[model samples]
Target chain A: MTREGWTRLGLVAAGIAALEALCRTKVIKPLTLVPPSRMVHDLAGLLIAGDIFDDIGQTAIEVGGAFFLAIVLGVLMGAAIQATPRLRRAVAPVLASWYAVPSFVFYPLLVALFGLSTSPLIAIGVLSATPAMVVATIGGLDRVPRVLLRAARIHRLTAAQTLWLITLPSALPSLFTGLKLSFAYAFIGVIAGEFILSGGGIGYGIAYAYESFETPKMYALMLLVLIVAVGVNGALHAWEGRLLQRRQR
Target chain B: MTRLFDSLAIVAGILLLWTGVFEYAGDSAITGPLQTFRFAANLLGRADFWQHAQATLSAFGYALAISAVAGIALGLILGLHRFSGDVAEPMLASLYTIPKVTLYPLMLLVFGLGVSAKVAFGVIHGMIPVILFTLSAVKNIPQVLLRTAKALHLTPMQTATHLLAPAVLPEIISGLRIGFALTFLGVLIGEMFASQRGLGFLIINGINSHDVKRTTAVILIVITASVAANGALLALDRRAHH
Candidate 1:
C-alpha cells in the first residue's frame, strides 16, 4: 500500500477507537449509539441465527433485477439516441436534469399501479438507476474516437464486428462507471423504498427495529448494510483497477 | 426556434405518455396529466400546501448553504495540501457511493424527528459532490498561475479572489447543480420516513389514505419545481463553463 493508503487505514482505526472509548466512558449513551464492537458482535450473532436471511434475499433480488434491467435498457436506449441526432437533441435537457426530481416521489404511484409487492421496489430502483447508466453510455459513446470508426469502415468491418472489437472495448471504462453507479443507485433505491414503504427487506428490518426500540438489533442491521455497501464498492474499485492495469499492458 | 419546437415536442410526448398510461390503468391507479395539472393548481392555491412546501424549502435551503460553505472550505484546504487530498479523495469517493439511507435511523436518533434531522440528511447527501468538484478544480489550476501570483507577492486573500475563485467557479457550479438535486432528495426521504410535514409527508400521507389524486398532484408539483430549478442552474453552469 502507498503512504496515503496507510494513513487512511490509520485514520479509520483511530476514528473507531475514539468512538469505542466514548461509548465505553458513557459520554455517548447506548441508546444513541452502541460501541462499534457490540454492533459487529450482534451482526455476527444475527447472521448465525439466520432470521434476517429472507429480508436479505428479498433486497438482493430487487437490487439485482433493477441493475440488470437498467444496464440492458440504458445501453439500448443510449445507443438508439446516439444514432439519432434529432432524438438526442430533444432529450438532452431532460436527461441532464433527470436526477434533480426525486423519482422516489413516484413510489406511491408505482405501488398504486403495481400493488404492494417487490415489483414497485424494483420499478423504483430501475427509475433511479437507469438514467445513470444511460448518461454514462452516451458519454462513453461520445468519447469513442472518430478515427477508429473511419478505420473500421476502411477495413470494411461489419457493424457488429466494429462494435465488438472496437467500440465496446473503447467504451468499457465509462460503461464500468455506469455499472458501478447503477448498482449503487439500485441498492439505494430498493433499500430506501423498503425503508419508506415496503413491508420487508433489510431496510424494513432496521425501521422495524427502530420503532420497536430494538436499538442493538437496529445497529447490527445498520452495520450489515455498511459492511455490504463498502465491501461491494471496494471489490468493484479493485476489479476496475486491475482491468485498467491489464489494458495499459 | 428549433430548440423551442423540440422542447414543446418533448413536453407533448410526456403528456401523451401520461394520458396513455392513465387510459390503460384507469382512474383508480393514476390520474391523467390534465387532471393532475388541475389538481396541482388547486393544491397550490391552498395555504396548507404552502406550509408543507415551506418546511421542505427552508430545510433544503439551510442544508445547501451549509454544504456549500463547509464543502468548499474543506475542498480548498485539501486541494492546497497535496498529501491530504490524495489521502482523502478515495475515502470521500467511497463515502459518496454508499447507500446513506441506512443511516437515516441513526440521524433520527441523534437529531430526533425534526427539521434538523432533515437538514443534516440533506447536507450529507449534498456536500460530498461539492467537496470533490472543488478539490479537483483547485488541483487542475495551472502551477504557472500560482507561481505568477507568488512572484507578484500577493496576499492569500488576493490570490484566492483573483486567481483561485475564477478558475474553480465552473466546476464548483457543476458540483452545486448535483448537490442541489441530492439535497432535495435527502430532505424528501427524511420527511417521508419520520416527519409530519413537507411535500414528502404529503405524498406518503396521500398514499396511506389512498388519495390517488392528491399523491399524483403533489408529485407533479415537486417534479415541476425541481426540474425548473435544475434548468436554471444548468443554464448558469453552461455560462460559467463558456
Candidate 2:
C-alpha cells in the first residue's frame, strides 16, 4: 500500500481501538453504543441468519427501478429542453430553484397515494434524482462543441445520425458524471424514504432495531449500509477512471 | 419581456398538465392548482403553521451555526497539513458516500427524541461538505501566496486571518450554500421521523389523518421557503464570487 493508504488504515484502526476501549471500559454506555467487535460479531450472526438479504434485495430493486426511470425520463426531458433555447431559458431558473427544496416534503403525499409499499420509496427516488440527471444532460449538451455540429451538417449527416455518433459521444463524460450523481441522490432518497415511510430495507431495519432497543443490531445494520455505500462509491470511481483512460487513448 | 412571457407560458403548461393528470386520475386528494392555492391561502391565516415553521427554522439555524464553526475549524486543521489531508481525504470520502439519514436513528438514541437530535442530524449532513470544500480551498491556495506569507515572517495566526481567510472565503461561502440546503433537509427528516413539532411533523400528521388540503398547504409552504432561501444564498454566492 502507498504511504497515504497506510496512514488511513492506521487512523481507522486507532479509532476502532479507542471505541472498543471506551465501550469495554463502560466509559460510554453499552446501551447507547455497541463496541465494534461486538457489532462485527452480531453482523456475522445476521449474515448467517440471512434474513437481512430480503430487505437488502427490496431496497436494491427499488434503487434500480428508480434509477432506470430517472435516466430514461431525465435524458429525454433534458435533451428536448436543450434543443430549444427559449424553453431552456424559461425553465432553468425554476429547475435551479427546485433543486434546493427538500423534495421529502412530497414524501407524505407519495405515501398517501401509494401507501407503505416500495412504490412510494421508488417514486421519491425518481423525483429527487431525475432533476440532477436532467440538469447534467442539459449542461453536457451545452458543452458539446458548435464546430462539431457544423462539421456534421457540412457532411450532410442526418439529425439522428449526428446526434447518435457525434453529440452523444462528446457529451458522454458529462452525462456519466450526471449518472453518478443521480445514483447518489437515488440511494439517499430510497434510504430516507424507507426511514420515514417505515416499511422495508436497511433503513427500516435500523429504525426497528432502535425502537426495540437492539443496539448491537442497529449498529450492525448501520455498518452494512456503510459497507454498501463504500463499495458502490469505489466501483463508480473505478469505472470513471477506466472511462477517462479510454478517452485519453 | 419575452423571457418573462416564456416563463409564464411554461408555468401555464405545467399547471395545465397537472390539471389534466388530476382530471384523468380522478383522485380527490390530488386537487388542481386552484383548490391547492385556495387551501394554501387559508393556511396563511392559521397560527399553527407559523409555530411549526418556527420549530423547523430554529433547529436549522442552530445546526447551521454549530456546523459552520465545527466544520471550518476541523477543515482548517486537516487541510493546512499535507500529511494529515492525504491520510484523511479518502477516509472522509468513504464516510461521505454513506447516506447520512441512516444515522438518524443513532442520533435519536444519542441525543434523544428532541431538538438536540434534529440539530445533531442536521450538523452531520451539513458539516461534511463544508469541511471538504474548506480543505480543497486551503489546498488550492496559490504557491505564491504561501511564499509571500513565509517571506514576511508572519505568525501562524497572522497568516490564517490575513492570508488564508481572504483567499478561501468565497469558496467557503459557496460551500455553506450547499451546507445550508442539506442541513435544512436533515432537520426536516429528523422532524418527520420522531419530532412532536416542526413543519415536517405537521405534514406527517396531516398525512396520517388523511388531511390532503393541510398536507398540500404545508408542502407548498416548505417548498416556497426552501426555494426563497436558496435564491437568497445564490445571490450571496454570486456576490462573493465577484
Candidate 3:
C-alpha cells in the first residue's frame, strides 16, 4: 500500500481506539456522544432498515433540481456577459462583491416566496450555486486561446459554427468546475434549508435525532452524509478527469 | 469614464427590470424598489437593526480571529512535516467536503446556544480553508528559495518572517477571503437556527410575523454590509499582491 494509505489507516485506527477508551472509561458521556463502534452498528441497522432512503431521495432531488436550474441560468448569464465584453467588465465587480454575501440570507426570501416546501430548498441551492457557475463559465471561455479564434476566422467558419466547434470544447474544463461547485453548494444550501425549514432531508434527520436525543442515530446520519458527499464528489471528479482526457485527444 | 457609464447603465437596466417584475407580481406585501429603498433607509436609522448587525459582525470577527491564529499555526506545522501532511491532508479535505452545518447540533451540544456556539461554528467553517491554503502554500515553496535561505545561515524565525511569510501571503489572503465568507455564513446559519439575537434572528422574526418589509430591510442591510466588507478585503488583497 502507498504511504498515504497506511498513514490514513493508522490515524483512523488510533482515533477509534481513543474514542472507545474514552467511552469505556466514562470520561465522556456516552448519552451525548456515541462511541465509534456503536455509530457503525447503528449505521448498519439504518441501512438494513432502508427507511432513510426517502429523506436521501428528497435531498438528492432538491440538489439535482437546483443544480439543473443553476446550469441553465448561469450558463445563459455567462454567455450573455461573455458575448458583451462591456457588460462582463461592468458586472465583474458586482459579482466579486456578491461572492462574500452568505447565500443562506436568500433562504428567507425563498421561503417567503415558495412557503415551507421543497421549492424553497431548491431555490436556495440555485440562488447560491449560480454565481460560481457564471464565474467558471466566463473563466473557462477566457482561457481559450485567441489564436484559435483567428484560425477559425481564417477558415471562414461562421460565428455559430466556431463557437460550437471550438469555444465550448475549450471551455469544458472550467464549465465542469462550475458544475462541480454548483453541485456542492447546492447540496449545502438544501441541507441547511432542510434544517431550518423542517423539509424532509438528511439534514432534517440530523436535527430530529438531536432534538429527541438520539445521539447514536444522529452520528449515524452524519456519517451517512459524509459518505454521500465523498462518494458524489469522488464520482464527479473522476468523470471530470475522463472528460478532460477525451478533450485532449 | 465610459466603463463607469456602462456599469451605471447596466444597474439602471436591472433596476428597471426589477421594477417591472415587482409591478407584474403585484404583491402588496412585497414592496417595489422605491418602497424597499425607503424601508431599508428607515431600518438603517433604527437602533434595533444596528444592534443586530453588531451582534452578527462581532461574532464573525471573533471567529475569524480565532481561526486565523489556529489555522496558520497548525497549517505551518502540518505543511512543514511530510508525515503529518500525508496523514492529515486527506482527512482535512474530506472534512471540508462535509457541510459544517451538519455539525451545528454537535457544536450546540458541546458549547450550548448563543454567541459561543455561533463562534465555534464559524471557526470550524473558516479554519479548514485557511489550513488547506497555507499547507499548499508551504508545500509549493520553491526548493531553491529554501536552499538560498539555508546557505545564508538564516535563523528559523528569520526564514519564516522573510522567506516563508512573503511566499505564502497571496495564497493566505485568498484563503482568508474564502474563510471570511464561510465564517459569515456559519454565524448567520447558527444564529438562524438557534439564536435569540443577531441579524439572522431579526430576519427569522420578521418572517414569522409575516413582516415582509422588515425581512427585506434586514436582507438588504446584510447584503450591503457583506459586499462592502468583501470589497475592502479585495482591495487589501490587491494591494498586498501588488
lDDT per residue as tens, model 2, B109-155? 68999899889888988898888888888989999999999999999
Higher-ranked by lDDT: 2 or 3: 2
Q: Please rank every candidate by DockQ, starting with the best.
A: 1, 2, 3
Q: Residue B221 CA error for candidate 1 (Å)?
A: 1.0
**Which DockQ values do the candidates obtain, in the order shown?**
0.72, 0.58, 0.51
Best by lDDT: 1
Scored against the true structure, residue B38 in model 3 reaches a CA lDDT of: 96
Off by over 4 Å in 1: none
Task: Assign candidate 3 its CAPRI class.
Answer: medium
What is candidate 1's lDDT per residue for B1-242, written digit by digit as tens?
99899999999999998888798778877899888899999999999999999999999999999999999999999998999999999789778877788898789888999999999999999999999999999999999999999999999999989999999999999999999999998898888876999998998888788898998999899999999999999999999999
Candidate with the greatest DockQ versus the true structure:
1
Q: Estimate how well candidate 1 is docked, as a DockQ score.
A: 0.72
Residue B187 lDDT in candidate 3? 83
Docking class of 1: medium
Q: What is the lDDT of every predicted structure here?
A: 0.90, 0.84, 0.83
* Candidate 3 TM-score for chain A: 0.87
Instruction: Identify the superior model by DockQ, candidate 1 or candidate 3.
Output: 1
**lDDT, candidate 3, A19-41, per-residue tens:** 88898788888875778788889
The residue ranges of model 3 lying beyond 4 angstroms of the native Cα positions read A148-173, A240-249, B13-29
Lowest-sum lDDT 10-residue window in model 3 chain B: B21-30
